[model samples]
Target: MTTHCDFGASLNDYLRDRLVSGIRSESAKQKLLSEASLTFEQATKIVLSMEQAEKSAAALSIGRPERIHQMSSVVARRGRFDNGAQHSKTHSQTARSDNAGAAWRGAGGTAKV
Candidate 1:
């Protein structure tokens, strides 16, 4: 004998499993479910607002002109380093040093006076 499953129920169960695994915050999960119940326009506006807030925060954190330029330069340098290592003959050494540098930077780099 073969068992049959309800597709709608199966889909809902799959979505619930993904939500539980992907979202660490109970409040966020509930908010997502509630938003899913909204009309398309309302949901679109809510998502846009959330995205705008995130963009604003990122812009604020990166701060003023000079600092923003410096941050961009650092990001560019890291990207070049990453790309160069991808093409280098001694890729393992470069990768190891990159990991060590990241750890050291995270530890505050032995602060010099």
Candidate 2:
């Protein structure tokens, strides 16, 4: 059997250290280093997931207020807040066509249409 010379650190440990050093975020680097016997696979998964979440967050922040208003309007039109049940067919039709009639009715004004 042939024996190899012993390095101070195992290859996996060396690779893990290098991976931690390459991370741009100081907190992320610390998080990886804090793990007990962290494996390269685990570090890669954590970093990748963090990156994906950051991208999603950035995308959402671009039109956040407008997106929220649109979502709320859709939910209201779908009668989601009406006792958790959909509006009757007639009301649903009117709401789908023009929400102005529903708004007028709610404001104590009769819609001629």
* Ten contiguous residues with the weakest lDDT in model 2: 1-10
Residue pairs with backbone atoms closer than 3 Å in model 2 (clashes): none
TM-score of 1: 0.29
State which candidate has the highest TM-score. Answer: 2
Where in model 2 is the C-alpha error above 4 Å?
A: 1-9, 65-113
Q: What are the per-residue Cα lDDT tens digits for candidate 2 across 1-113?
A: 11364544576676677888899988788778788879977898888887888889998799789989998998888766566655467877867668776767877896544
Candidate 1 regions exceeding 4 Å error are 1-30, 63-113
Clashes of each: 0, 0
92: Cα error in model 2, Å: 44
| Root-mean-square deviation of candidate 1 | 17.9
Query: Model 1's lDDT to the true fold?
Result: 0.62
Q: Would you estimate the TM-scores of all the predictions?
A: 0.29, 0.46
